[model samples]
Every structure is written in C-alpha cells, then in structure tokens.
Target: MEERPNNDTTISTDEINVLLGKLKFSEEESVQIMSTNDGKNVKGFESWAVGKIMATEHPNREAMYRVFKSLWYTKEEVDFVALKEGAVIVKFGCLEDRSRILKLMPWLFDKCLFSMVPFVKGKNIASYEFGLSPFWLRVYNIPIELMDRQLVVAVGNAIGELVAIDWKDRNGAWTEFMRLKVKIDISKPLRRIVKLVSRYGGETIEVIKYERLPDFCYMCGLIGHTFKNCKDNREGAGINDSNAQYGSWMRAPFVNPNQERNMRRNGVEIVKTTITANEDKEESQTNSRDESGQSAQKGNEKEVKKARYRHHLWKKEVISLYMTAWDGLSIRGSA
Candidate 1:
C-alpha cells in the first residue's frame, strides 16, 4: 500500500522525482559508454552521414544503439558517441539508416524524448543553423560611457555575426525586461584576438569558448529557439520577417541612469570584502605553516570553512535581491 503525500510535508515524491530527472550526466560514468566498432578505423559516411541527437538525460550507448537496431532490424547495426552536453553523435552503418532516422524526425527511447538534427561534417554546428553565427566576446574594463547601442553594434559588426549584447542592468521598470541573449556556434574553432580596434583603440577583448550560448524566443517567450523560428503561433497570428522586430524591452536601453553609482558602491564593498578575505587566508596559511609542519591539512580545513561561510552569505544576498526584484516585477506587471 502506498501512503499519500501529506500536505504538511516539505517536498512530495513527485517533486523529488522532478529534481532527479534534471540531474546532469556524470562524465565519469559516460567515459566507458562507447558503442562497439567492428574493427573499422575510419568513419564510413564522414560528414554527410551523422545525426546529432539531443535529450534531457544522456542516453546509454547500448540503449541508443538499440533504438537504431530496432529500426534497422539488425542486432549490432548502429554506432554512437555521447557528447558532454547530453547530445549524442550516432553514425549508422549505411546511408539508409541515416535516412530512416531523419524521416522519423523526433525520437523516443526508454521514456526519454529526443530531438534529432543532421550533423554536417567539416563545417561547425553554427553553419547548420539558419540565423547569425554565434560567439561570446568579453570586453575588459569597458568604459561605462561607451556601453550603449553604438558600442554593441560596433563590436557585433566586428565579429562575423552581430546577434545581440549580453549584459542587462535595468534602467527602467523591472516588469517587462528579460535577460540579454546571443547566438553561439558550437563547431567553429574559437578565435581569440586580444586587441579590439574601435574609436577607443587598444581595448583588449577576450573571447572565451562556452559549451552553450543564449537561446531565447521573444515571440513565444521560450528558451530553446529564437523569435524567427518560434512555432508558438501556427495559425493566423504567425510571426514573419517584416513583423519580426524586438519587443519593448529589447528596443530600449536596460541600464538605469543611476545604475553606475549603485554599481560603484556595490563593487567597492564586494572588492574590499574579497581582498580582506584573501589576505586573511594567506596570513592564516602562513601562521599555520610556521606553527606546525603539516599545513596541508590545516589549509584544507580553513578553505572548506571559508568556502561554506562565503557560499551561505552569497546565497542569502542573492535570495534577498531576487525577492526584491520579483516584487518590483509583480507591481510593474499589474500596471
């Protein structure tokens, strides 16, 4: 007999299951998850014959191969490699297997949903997409004066594709504004150029490679796709090119006029605390080593203690800020 969840309980079984479902795939566990290859040194299809399969949870290699095996009606007919980001690269024994998978489009195996797309060889992941090329450009010590639309456009044009800026400090009401988003190419080899030559020359721009990029759909208020490709409205209220403009929040600058002053005050406090903590840590380590020869154990203990304290404080502050922001957003939404 199953006991029903009591209303007074903090978390129900369903909630626990939901959290468990979102658990990230362990790299250690996935290291040994490779499909069997029958002594073939080279890939058969190369670029034109691979499929990129995405899922919420990383599928087991044997289970993934089984999906194809069932489809192809063979015992060991498919080979696959799992990516770190829960995506899988499935190489079929023949072009016919590839075609059949593509024809089926969306796939389901062992109660897990999956999205399948073609894997183009030689070209990167960004090249397969319809919109602009994706990349993350980090500007160091950007002059607060130049953080405007003009700067965004200039830096964007300098890169291959000018998608969107990636910073948000609300200058106005918090109601409608959302986080900034940009496109990113997964396949292209990262190119990091130190100097960004603008009207303000000699500014150093750092390009860091990230596993994923910003994906927000303004049209449908979704996260995976952009507004252009959103299928939220399949009927008469379709979004097309001419009408595909930015929302009200996107059109206006996010920064409040007084944000710089507030940021300066907060930055000063955070920097001072961080510096003080670092200095204290160094002093403690030095004193520990001087007093006792075994500083390693003492140092580890101190680090763990410091990390926990900092994390607790940080979490509290974040929760406070989030609540404050949420209230503001609620008021604005009502208006």
Candidate 2:
C-alpha cells in the first residue's frame, strides 16, 4: 500500500492544553440571566396538582384520566396529562375544584394509591416527591375512655403526620376501634402496631389497620410491591406466608355502617317476634295445665322465670348487634 497518514494518532498533553488555552470567554458571556417577568408565564399553573401513582407497573393513563374525571365530579372541567414514571399533572378549571381535590387526598386508582401535592411555580414535575400518603387507620385495642382526640393525635403522629381524626359519632359513644387520618411515609415499612403507655405506667399493644389499603409487601411491609417481587426478600432467604411479618391483617375490612344498621334493625325485629311467639306458647301451655295440680302451677312459674331470663339475654344480644354495626362504620373523614 502507498504511505498513508495515521488518523488514529493521539494528541499530546501539551497540544491539548494549547488548544484549550486558545478558547476565550468574554465578561458578558460568563453568566446568563432571565427577566423577572418570567413568573407570569407560569402563573396559570398555580392551581395545578402534580402526582404519581405508587405502583410497580405503570398505570393506564387513559383509564386513570377517565376515573379521576368521573370521581372528581367537578362543576368545571378538569384536565389530566400523563408524564414519565406514572407521574401525572392535573389542571383544574377553577380554584374551587383544585382545593376540593386536594382536600380528598390519598385517592385510589384500581386500588393503588395516587399521592399528590400542589404544583409549585417553576418547579419541575418530576422533582415533586410522592413519599407521603394519607391513610385512615382503624386503631384497635384502645379503651373507650382513651379514644379521645389527644390519643388519636398521638397515635397518628407516631405512625406519620397527624392529618385529621375521624370523629364519626365519637361523642362519648363506644366504638370497636378509633379511626385516625394519618399521613404516612409510604417509602418505609407500614406500621403494623403501636404501643401505648398509660399514665399509670401500664403498656398496651394496639393493632393498626388501614382502610382502603393498596398492595404492599408482606415480607418487607413496604407499600407499592408484593412479597413475591420484594427486592429485600429476593436478596435474602426466601419468605413465605407463614414467616412474613405483614399479612392480609394490615388491610381493614370495608363495611357500610348504614347497611349494617339496617340488618341489625331487622335482626332486632325478628328477635322480638320470636320472643312474642314463645311467650304466647308458654301461656297456652300454662292454661292447659292449670287444672293438673299445685305442682303443675309451680312448674309453670319456673318456666315463666326461664322465659324472662331468655328475653333478657335476647335484649342484650340486640344491643350488642347495634353496637357492632356502629363500630364498623366507614372512616369518611379525609384531609
């Protein structure tokens, strides 16, 4: 071949330094500034909300848009724009609509939590963090007397930020469990229990249950993924249902209190009818046996007393049913 120049020849250190030194920067080119009036360009986005759906798999943007539009029911039109990594930006038609949506925080889509925060001016949509999410926790094992605002606040703050307390019919009425609206850090493992210490130095372990809870890792107790896909579980020895710390117990059961009330009312009526029928049958038997002897009369008295005792037990059972219905009411308070 004929002599050819080596195109792959490396540049020497001194030659590179000389080439770099040839470049110059003027004072005017040192820094670039924008006008202060740039703020007005993004003023319209002040009422916007930016959020992300906390799910391992990306959510269906179109389905989510439809679901939120239907669920919000805003008087004015609302807009949704899907972004990368399950992130979404919402534009409300009016300030009222924006405020209403934020008030209903911790919304769910296909049972996955959609955590959101108010959009800030000049802030990048991806910069917003969705670490905190609001959840309604039904605290069990708390005494009736201890189900006060102070106790709820304390317990709520222990798990996360105390958003609000669901004081649904809590005016001196007993409930199966106290309901608290807490802003929890979903980045960490969900708190399964809280220990309470009385002023007398007595300790009580209270079980925490979440209402409308989404998918979570049973092995690691973290939200967003299940035990089968948990990274921590994969990195260590395998875990199964028997050895997992968290289970289905973390999710609270959904019960419609109104429906429960109606059912219990019908139950009470049925018990009343049964008691009436039993009493009528006993009276007829006693009348038939009246002419038998004094022994028969005494036996009827014993039967009457037994019937009365049974009636008393039924009344107590009716009361128990009513109480149970009220205690299982849905935690409607949100913030």
Candidate 3:
C-alpha cells in the first residue's frame, strides 16, 4: 500500500511573514507614484456620477440598467458599472446628459429610490454620500391667503433646499394643495408636518405628503428600507407599526394628467389665484411688519435652527450605523 500525504495544511502568521520576507523586488518595480493630473486624464473622468440604489435587495444589474436607460431617455448613451454595496459608477456621454439626470433625481427603480451625486475627482467612490434626494411635497392645510410663492419658498427652505414650485395648472387655477420640490435628507426622519405662526400670533399646521414615496421605515421615519429590516427593529428595540410616528397618510395621492384634462373639459372649476411675482413683492414691502412680528419671526427662526440641529444629529447616527455594519462584514484578502 502507498502512503498518502495530508492534503490539509495551516500556515501561521510568523511563517507567512517569513516567506514574504524572502521575496525581493527589482529597483524599477519597487516604487511607483502618480499625481492628481494623471487621474484627471483618465477616461470618463469628466462626465461621471456615483449612484447607490437605496434598498437591501438589489435588482439584476443588467435589468436595472435597461430600466434606467428607458426612464432617463438621455440624448447620449450612458454606462453603468456596478460596485460594492449596491453602488454604481455612471458614465454619461456628455455633461449635459449628466446634469439632466441629476436634476431629475430621486428616481425609482423596482420601487426603491435611487440617490446619486456628481463624482468628485480623486475621491474614493465608496466615500461618496447618497443621503440627499429631491421630493415633490403636497402641502395641505395652508391658508388660502398664504399660498403665495414667498410663503412656499419660506416653508420649503425650512424643510430642505427649495428647487421649484408648481404655480398653477394649464387653466391658471390653483390646486387643492401647495406643490413644491425640495431636496430632503433621507438619513433623517421625514418631516410629516410643519407648523407656521402668523404675525398675529396664530399658528397653522400644514400636513406634508410626498409624491411617489417608496418603502420607508415607519418606526424610524427613514427612507431606503422598511421597518422590518431597520436596525432598531432587527434588534427588537423598535416599536410596532401601529404606534409608529409615520404612516400611509404621508403619501400623497397620484394625480393623473389625463384625469386633469378631463376635469378641465368637463368644466370643473378649480379655485383660481392669479399671483404674480410683482404682487408678491408688493405684499412683502407693504407688510413690513417689523419687530412687532418678532414672535412669529422667532418661531420660524427656531424651526430653522432645529432643522440644522437635526441634520448634525443625523450625520452622527449615519457614521455609527456604517461602522457597526462594516464590522459585521467578513473581509478576505492577503496582506
């Protein structure tokens, strides 16, 4: 009978280090350096963006790309390269196409929000943050008198960066609610309601409803994941859905364009408010209600300060979550 050698073997750290020490490299191959200018000359460096699909389960990369291509309908062809942790490097044929795609952000793929940011040269793609996205909000319960563009801008700024406003319909009639686009930070809880204080010391509550909102955590109010997969819920430290701070009421009803046209043809009259920029300006100048309205101004200032504070808190929370999640991932590589 022939003797067989053991197939399994283990190498200790010291043994591996000793073997590595025995290897030698030529002077020419020992050291190499590159400058930032070298990186700039790389292909697709000028027209690229980093994106992440905000979902735990990523869709088929090919299928997702096809869907995005159709949805974007850019003038030039776009390329998508999948990266670690559901991130992708998107290459556009031109800067125009890239800017257009980014402007129409918060795109939905398989019912999940896709957040993107313009690529920064020499920055690690993994370090790019995908926490902010623009959303169209339908603000309800706003007083008819305060439905002007100035008021909308003020409230929109308090919530997030104001992008644009839907002034009126084709018939020049105001909709039931104020519609404005604002960039929101998805890392923090969604703001469901905003309180406005008038110069008369009266308060009004405005209910915020998002259009085309995807699955989000009802318990924590964060977007990208449902409560079931939330860290708080996974650890059994979160509350039940019934007692959650957010609910379906936060989602706004979708308005169909065809339906709107039908309504217009059927002679349905929507409340008309012909507000011009000049009118808004005149109103502002005439009502220079000074420090007497200090209480109301202070209220708004306090809300803005609070929003800033919440943003800082969210950054800390995100850092903690990232560290905890990274620690759990099993890494395999050679030194």
Q: Which prediction has the highest TM-score against the true structure?
A: 3
Tens digit of lDDT per residue, candidate 1, span 1-335? 99887775555456778998888869885577667965343336442243433222334556555544544442226667764334466676655556544432233343233445556655543334422233334443444555565555554454444443333333431122212222433233233332455575556553322212223454643334455565565666756556744332322223332453332111111222333457667666677787787775566556545654553454333333332332243233233
**Clashing residue pairs, candidate 3?**
none
Error of 1 at 292 (Å): 99
The alpha-carbon deviation from the true structure for residue 211 of candidate 2, after best TM-score superposition, in angstroms, is 1.0
TM-scores for every predicted model: 0.24, 0.63, 0.65
> Candidate 3, residues 1-335: lDDT per residue as tens digits?
99776795656556778998998979987888765664444346688899888877665667667766755666788999887667899998778778767755567665678788998887866578898888878898988787786788798889997765665433454457777778898888999999999989999999999977877988788887887888777564657556878888899874454443332221111111122323464355345546355555555445444543443443333323322322222221000
Give the whole-model CA lDDT for all candidates, comma-separated: 0.42, 0.68, 0.68
**Collision pairs in model 1:** 134-183, 134-184, 171-254, 171-255, 171-256
Q: Is candidate 1 or 3 superior in lDDT? A: 3
Q: Which candidate do you rate higher for TM-score, 1 or 2?
A: 2
85 Cα displacement, candidate 1 (Å) = 2.0
* Candidate 3, superposed: residue stretches over 4 Å from native: 1-25, 30-43, 169-171, 234-242, 257-335
Clashes of 2: 0
Tens-digit lDDT string for candidate 2 (135-177)? 7778998877787756876787788977655454323343677
Q: How does candidate 1 fare on TM-score?
A: 0.24
Error of 1 at 161 (Å): 25
Clashes of each: 5, 0, 0
